[model samples]
Each structure stands twice: as C-alpha cells, then as structure tokens.
Target: MSLTHLPSLHRPASHGAGVRHKAQSMLHWGLSQGLPNVVVKMAARKGDLQGLLTQAGSGDEIWEVIDQVRAQGPLVKGRVTFITADHAVVSEVLTSKAFRTGNPLDRLGFLATASIRLRPDTMHPLVEPSLLVTEPPDHTRYRKLVTRVFTMRAVEKLRDRAETVARELLDELEGRVDLVEQYCSLLPVTLISQILGIPTSERRNVLAMGSDIAASLDFGLSWPEYRDVDAGLRRFDAWQEAHIETLRKNPGDDLLSQLVHVQDEDGTLDMAELKATAGLVLAAGFETTVNLLGNGIKLLHDNPEELSKLQQDPALWPNAVEEVLRIDPPVLLTARFAPEPTTLEGQYISAGLQVVVLLAGANRDPHVFEDPTRFDVTRANARDHLSFSAGRHHCLGAALARMEGEVGLKSFFDRYPDVTLLPGAQRRPTRILRGWRTLPAQV
Candidate 1:
C-alpha cells in the first residue's frame, strides 16, 4: 500500500492548509485521547486496577497488576471499565450472549465519540465492518465464509508450506540476527501474503503497514502517533481497493480470490465489507503469530530445561506451543460490553458497561492452571488458555497460528540448537499487543 496514488481524502488541500490540518488533528487527539488519559492517570494514582494495568511497564509489572486484580475478586470496577482476571469470569463474559463486542469510545463523552466518528476516512481497524467489532447475523455470515478457508483440514494442507517457509527463513540467518525482523516476522507474513495472493515483493510493505496500524488496538495515542497510523490506514485503504479490483478482473487460487468469488444464500459481500474482511485477515493473519514466535524463543531461551524437554521429545512441540501461548500470550487484553443488564459470577453488570478481560491474566489463573506462573512444557490442560479468546468471537485463525508457531519455533531451534537471546531485545510499546519488537539473537 504505497502512498503515491492516495485519494483526495488522504491528501492535504494545500501547502498553507497543512498547519490547519495539524491543528485539527491535535484537537481531535485532545478530545479522543488526551482527556481520557488524564482520567486514567488520576485513577492510577488512586490505585484503580484498570489504570494500573495501563501503567504496567514490563511483563513482570503486568503480572503484578494482574495479581492485584485477582486479589480484588471476580469483578472489580475501574475508572472507565470493569476488570476481570478470573478465568471462569472471563470465559463467562466472552461466551455469554448478554455481553457483546462494542466500540471502545462508547463510554467516552459525546465530544470524544464525535471527534472519532467525524473522521470516516481514517477507519479504525477495531471499528465497524472489521470482524473484531461486528456481532450476530453479519458476524455469523462473515465467520461462515471465512471459516470455509481456515478449517483444520484446510490449515493442514498448508503445514508443508509453513514448514518450507520456516526452513527457508532460518536458512538465511547467520551467527547474529534480529530474529523478529529477519525470521519471526517474515515467516508468517510470507504465508499470509501467499494466502491473500499478495505478491512476494509487497510483503515488506504490507508488514510495515500492519505494524503501524497495530497501535489502533491500544486505548490512547498521541497526535503524532495517531497521525502516522491514520496515514498508514489511508495507504492501506487505497492499496486494498486497487488490489480487490485486480482480483475481481483476474482471480487466482488463493483464499482472497475465493473470498472475492464466494457466495452464500444471502448473496455476496459488498465492496466495503470485502475490504474490511480482507484487511482484517491481512493484519491479523500475522501480527499475533509474530509475537507467538518471538515469545516462544525468549521463553525457551530463559528455560533451558524446558527447551531440553522439547529436544528430547519432538512430539511435545504442539503442546509446547500451547504452553508458550499460555505463559506469554501475544495479545494482553480485550474489552467486551454488556448490551443489557447481565449477571456474572453473582455480580450484576449494568447495561452498556465495558468489561476488560485480561487474557494474559486469565491464562495464569490458579483456579484453572496448576502452578500458573511456572513455564512448564508438560503442563496438562495447557490448551485451555484464553489466548485465542472463546465462544462467538474466537480467533478464526487459531489453527493456523498454532501451526505457524509450532513450525516456526521448532524449525528455528532445530536449526540453531545453540541459539541465545542477546541483551538488546526490546518489547513493543503498545499496551494491547504484547511481544518483542527487536529480539537480537546469537546462533
């Protein structure tokens, strides 16, 4: 998605008007983010669980906050949203019909909601049309269509290809490398691009666009950050439109091509819906898997005993992937809203209340997993983790992510048994997505 041919909506009106646009963007940020951040900060000082979750820095810090939330009980009130760390409560909130996916800004004031709604051109990835926020009939139809291409049988057909991609990516690495940029990121991006029929030459550009737009999942953003993300979204929009047209004219044997031509009893998806689905697949197809791979590498590196267990019994690879996801998931948290009054774990939830389910926390709930904090490869019931969420909105690509995580991590370690994580590794700054941005490694 290059910016060379962006539509007028994305382009500035005139040289002088650039300053006016900047001022408008700043104002928008102030209403949509700045004020909310101030409230959160104040709540943090007052020891609010939600506020502390946002302020938590490292993985240890995040776990600490999760422990605090758990100590409070099943459901705790935050400054803006309800908080839950109990596995049972989190599962109930996600699976129950009483709670539904909603816009993050629903609770914010009218001015803040209006500020975001005013910019229809810069579509937030988490907003409407995207599968993440859609509910019921439309979501059901979209999921059915997407499910045809991502079933276990279908994903199994791609296993050989996934293995080949992982081997090829690892073959390019030398003694020292940034595992994220060179291996972890490339492996899944390459496969997802193939599924989408995106050309090999365009993968790097697509990856960059995905990374920039990923920040949209977080609660707040500064003016500069939001501006850059908006630009990236515009570029992606332009590119996706052109690509869809190309596919319409000349289809291929790819999942995207199938989506372009597939039909149901209710007829086909409109252009906008198609773009939203395809874009979600493109971004989501890789973003989390990259994290899974990186986290697996770090976890295995830190626990040589666990690594040795896998080396001794290659069959444990699949279960090890679950353990990695359970121990250090890619996504930190997700929010759900109660459409109507609901009762959960004996607590009454008022209508329109937003419940923030900490997936990372739920995965480590002691009631669910024994010795929750330990990174045990052989732990029973590791697959019970909420890393892929649950119920209606469960990850459509869960099977594929597991395949990629297993193939990518296993291939990396088998190729470089002596590989060690270097000191310069850094985590991504975004609060929602949790993973390493740069994982320096020595083979």
Candidate 2:
C-alpha cells in the first residue's frame, strides 16, 4: 500500500499517560499513521518490531526481513516511525540537511529513563553532550577541534605504527587461538590505546572499560551487562579525570594531550567536554574496527572463491575490504529526527519523530547493486556502501579504520597462509553492532 493510504487515528494533544502507556500508544499510533503496508502485514503475522527483532536471531534472518521491507517500498515504519531498507532512501535520509542526529533519549516518546535503563551513564553530563548526541553549533564546534588532531595526516603518521603493532601481535600468537580475542580485538585496542596515550599500566583496565562502553551502544542490554556498563563508566570517568589533570599540568604529544591543550576563540574544551571527547575517541576508535577485521575474515572463510581471488592478487585486498564492509557492516542501526514536519518518500513524518535507518539493509539493496547478496571481492561499487554513514556525522575515524582493516587482515593471512576457522564461532547478541563475539581458529 502507498504511504498516503496509511490509516488515520486520533492523536492525543497532550501525552499525559504514564511512560509505558504513552510509549505503547504512541508506537501503535505511529504505525497506523506512517508505517508501510508491508510492515503492518508482517506485524499481524509476527507481531511488531520487538517481536521481529527477537525472531531475527541470526544475521541471515535479519537480512531476509530487511529485504522484505525493501520490497514493499523505499520506507517502512518500525517502532521508531519512519524506517527505510532501501539504499537510495537510506542515503537521502542520512544526507538531507533537514534531518538531524537529534538526541535519541528525547525522541520516539520513549522516556529518558528507558535509555538510563540501558546504560545509566547517558544521564551524566560527562557523556550526554558529546558528539554522539549533539547537533548544529555543538557538533560543528567539537568536530572542528577534533579534526585538527584527527586528520588524515595524523592517521597516516600512525599507519607504520599500526602495521608494526599488527605484526607484533600476530608473532605472539600460538598454534591455535580465538582470533576474536587474540588478534582481532587486541591489535585495535592496543593501537588505539597508544594513539590516545593511555598509560601502559592502565591499558588493560581501559580496554576492558572501553569494551563495556562500546557494548552499551546497543539498543538495550541484559541486567548483568547493564551493571558492567555502569561500573565501566564510573571507572572510565575516574581514569579520565586523573589523566586530564596529568595532561593539563604536563602536556605531551598524544591525542589526549592535544585535546587538553586545544583552544579556539571560544577558549578550550571544558572538563566535561574533555572527558567526553577522550571517551568518544577511545570507544569509537577500536570497537567497530575490531568487527571489520573479524567480519572480513569470517566472510572470506565462508567464500573460498573470493578468498582465493584476494590471495592470488594482493592488490584486490582493498576492494575485498570494501566488499566485506558492504556485506557485513559494523554499526547496524542509526536514527535521524525531523526538526519540522516533512514528507519522506511521500510519507508524513511529524516533527520530533525518530526515523531509524538500517545500514545493513541499504548495503544489500538489489536496486543499488547487482546480485547484492553475492560475496564478490571484485565488486567495483563496493565503496558506495554507507558503512561509515554519511553527511556531517560520517565517522571521523573512517580513514583510520580502513587503514587498520587493510593492514590487520593482510598481515594475518601473510603470517598464516593456510589458517582455518574452527567450528562454533559465535556472534554478538546486540541490535546495533554486527560481528563475531568468539571466532576460534587454527594456524
């Protein structure tokens, strides 16, 4: 059915209902008002977004669901109202000036407490106004300062360093290891720690804390995971405070020190801003890159033909990496908000509404790429994928990520040309990130 044919319902002028009821009513009404007919039909058969997510226990199932939504049109409605599985629509939504990466805590009629329930640290000022949750002047200002230190030049300066670290880590590996833990996870964390100038004595603790913080990026977490995330933030905050004082008193040549000393006409970053910036870089730098390396190896292992092609012509490794990213992106879901009432692909999106963009779906849309599901390392348009997102909020660490993925994967295969993945590899159980949790393999 077309978007205009969506059912009309009486919307409450005032959301006086309690949080739970208000959210349920708002979600149901949004579906009726803005959801695609296909989504409504699916909900009738398998319940709503939550049910669908529960049923999609594997990556393949999630891809199938996304394909179904794409078949209906460019857009559908999930619980967050406007959702798109189409590649073109996802690009348009991400790049449009009218749309903003508004605060998720304030959108979708979901209580701020809901986010708190996921990870209580979001309520703290030290994490709340960071680039991840900002718009306009704030994002513009913060990104400008960061760009000075996080430039392509800066990343290039570390390329040789990262390559050295990758080689060293691979050398330390034994006959058999969980690649996820031994190499894939360790190399990135170690490289990022070095770049951030984290104390050598505190690197292990900081790595653990960073992992918990990264896990908290998922839509929600288990009770145990939540506690771990909360505790991680507390420890992370304390570390940042001590380091901030240290960097302030005796500046060094590290990113954290640069961030500490960075100043503009509006003075330097405040204490909270400093903490938030450091936390953001540390968390964002390592998390997704680990997935990229893990996911790339896993995909290549599953497709021997593609792997052989890369092994034969090492020049294809860069393109292979792009195809890997296109096939299995790291971050799965991102949202944008309509600052004013607008029409998206002919569907009405009210002001202050959340529109969830599924990057994995867009990467596989048949409308954009021929044989979208096939794992072809030689795919020419592979770089067209939105794995690092788009527009102003496009990932700041993208160049660094690409460099790491290339170096890390190449060095590993060179070290163990005949390495094979063991059975029983496990995937992370989270809505936002998509990659292996444990990938045992033998050299």
lDDT of 2 by residue, 1-443 (tens): 32222234224546433343334433433332223334544664654553365346446678766766776678876664667878888899889987887554454444343333333333232245677767778888888877754578887888898889999889888877999888888877887777777777877787676666665554334445545655666778888898889888988778888889887888988988888777777766788888999998888778888878878999998888888899999888787888888888888888887787888889988878899989999998999999889988888778778888988988888888678999989897766778888999988
Runs of candidate 1 exceeding 4 Å displacement:
1-24, 107-109
* Model 1 TM-score, 2 decimals: 0.94
TM-score list, all predictions = 0.94, 0.84
Instruction: Assess candidate 2 and give its lDDT.
Output: 0.74
- Per-residue CA lDDT of candidate 1, range 1-443, in tens? 32222243254456635654555566667776777778888999999988888778435679999999999998888777899998998999889888889764666577745666445365566777889999989899888887866788988899999999988888789988999999999998998999999988899999998888888777667767778877788888888888888888999998888888888898878788888899888766788899999999999999999999999999999999999999899988898988778777777778777899999999999999999999999998999999999999998888889999999999999999889788999999888889999999888
Worst 10 residues of 2 by lDDT: 1-10
lDDT at position 358, candidate 1: 92
Clash pairs, model 1 backbone: none
Residue 417 shift from truth in candidate 2, angstroms: 1.5
Q: In candidate 2, list every pair of residues with a backbone clash.
A: none
lDDT of 2 at 196: 76
